[model samples]
Target: MTLVEGSGCFVVTDEGVRLMDLVGGIAVNALGHCHPEVVEAASAQMRRLLHTSNLYYTTPQVELAEALVASAFPGRVFWCNSGAEANEAAIKVARKWGRLHRRGAFTVVTLEGAFHGRTLATLAATGNAHYSDPFRPLPEGFRQVPRGDLAAVERALVDPDRPGVAVLAEPIQGESGVNPLGTEYLVGLRELCDRHRALLILDEVQTGMGRTGTMWAHQAAGIVPDLMTAAKGLGGGLPLGAVLVSKTADCLEPGDHGSTFGGNPVACAAGLAAISVITRDRLFNRAAIAGDQLKEGILGFRAMGLPVADVRGSGLLLGIGLSEPWARELAGVALQEGLLINPIGAATIRLAPPLVISDDEIELALEGLRSSLVRVMRDKGL
Candidate 1:
């Protein structure tokens, strides 16, 4: 019998062993697993109303929409069920915006290492070929380019034949080991997109909702995208997503898109509660401070002879680069030491603990990492 009841940063396994959750349910548990407020909101809403189709409106749904639009990147909000749906809606808006305004340019440009989502359209938009190669004949008009190379993006934008190309990007490539796009490069891409009449779409599904210190990651660049997608933390573990569209791309007509369970009342209730907690409690600042602490701690470990190459990120969304491909082994060691963390790739370990994580938790996680690194290095004969 597997035990399945747990909450907050500590989880109890079936055997009754308690474990610290540093991954925060892969960044979805923003308020931590089954936060009391969120759980109460969801339960209360579920009892009142669960589903109310597009024909009707509910308070929770309306409140969530208002909250999302209020924090949006100068755009209107469209709700959905997950990150993939949000990306899909963003793609539709980009395509439609291009078709109507640019007279039939259908190409949407994305950067390599970007992880948009897993839906057919989003999987096509994702720049990673490993995810795309499995299913060939992907959706058309998604142009893949190297990330942070403004000159390459400029070339693609200037190609007159690709008239309707829209540049879709993640400010920081979270899934590809947390590679941050340079501020200069992002600004340059914005200018290029504007100059070439291409719509700029930011895939903020992982980086938005205060994950990167700011309310939104692209705020660092001071550029507003024509479209943006958010999901992971927006609902705070309630399974909700949204696509924000700029006024210019408000071309979505009735019946253009619809979802039966996109904005469920229960999910919206959870979203509203989560947003209230995040904004009122000031978790964004907490994430920034924790991020700085984590970075400094990791850097200190390097100074102590751990062969750490780089530690780059903003807020709580951080990635540690190793001198060798030992992230998996290191993660294994950390797990054995009673920490919950994940490897982004062969050489990178991604850290996205909850925004409400305590200072002690952060230090303990870092200590676990330091010890794991020492053990893995010795085991690997490094």
Candidate 2:
């Protein structure tokens, strides 16, 4: 049935109905589907130069790197294929950084309920057991600390047996139902990492690139991570990711790491276009305003006794927790009603509408949720 055909915020299927894309490819399509500027840039770059090995530098890659560095990152950028690759690169940097000081400082401290990527190392870095259980006995040295527990983190860092190399965490646990770490925790983490000489690695793959109303989610916490894994919205639907490193964390010397198609001209062009669209168009501000509207809309629905438990998040990345575990069923109802939304887990429904969604589109999704909830309640005899 082609589940979805044609693009933009709305898509059509073999069923011949248009559906709004509220998930944005799980927060990848920053400009939405088939954006004219991105599409044209990609097409032009592809027709001119598709890809080149990293042995030789490409203009688009260098330009994109320069842009990222000039921005808040102001450091080296390592090109990669996706979020997993970005995290992989970051882990390597952290490990290498640790090895610089001494041996066995390879342990990485992660938080519970954090999702980094699907790769083996990233999977281990991810705190969720379900994802890691399938591939048990993962790479060693990844330790999970209860999120927001400063004492656990302190012990991990100060362990005399082996020094902790880095602290890997997501500013907000997106895949684990959008659990945001407290800003106080982040502040303390920065201070702790500074004291222990451990790098603070933030997996911003899901929360970066203006998805959280700020250019990066950590900006809200007033801390800068040593390395930031960026993806989801970087390529504007193209397969692209980056490991943004601070000057001190730039440990990957030339030839230390490289990717064949990491900085393909087409993907780089798409990334440049995406960043241009995000910065020039002020999508961050737009997301902030839209997110506030959506949050208020969700809170209003909850106040109406819609069974919505807690509505929280900044910007377009909002998570709605239902009083009952009806999210799985409600997702189907929303899809049937021509609105595409995704449930993060059994009880939490995550809504990440495109940064380009209009006021009317937001209203439509709110209404769709209202209708879907009614159908769910009716079926459950609530």
lDDT of 1 by residue, 92-193 (tens): 888887778888888888888888888778889885678888887788888778877888887777678775468988998889988889688889888998
Candidate 1 worst ten-residue window by lDDT? 1-10
lDDT of 2 by residue, 148-199 (tens): 7999999999888866899999888899998888699988988999999899
TM-score of each: 0.96, 0.97
> After superposition, which runs of candidate 1 have C-alpha atoms over 4 Å from their true positions?
1-3
For all candidates in order, the CA lDDT equals 0.84, 0.86
Stretches of candidate 2 exceeding 4 Å from the true structure: 4-6
RMSD vs true structure, all candidates:
1.6, 1.3
lDDT of 2 at 110: 91
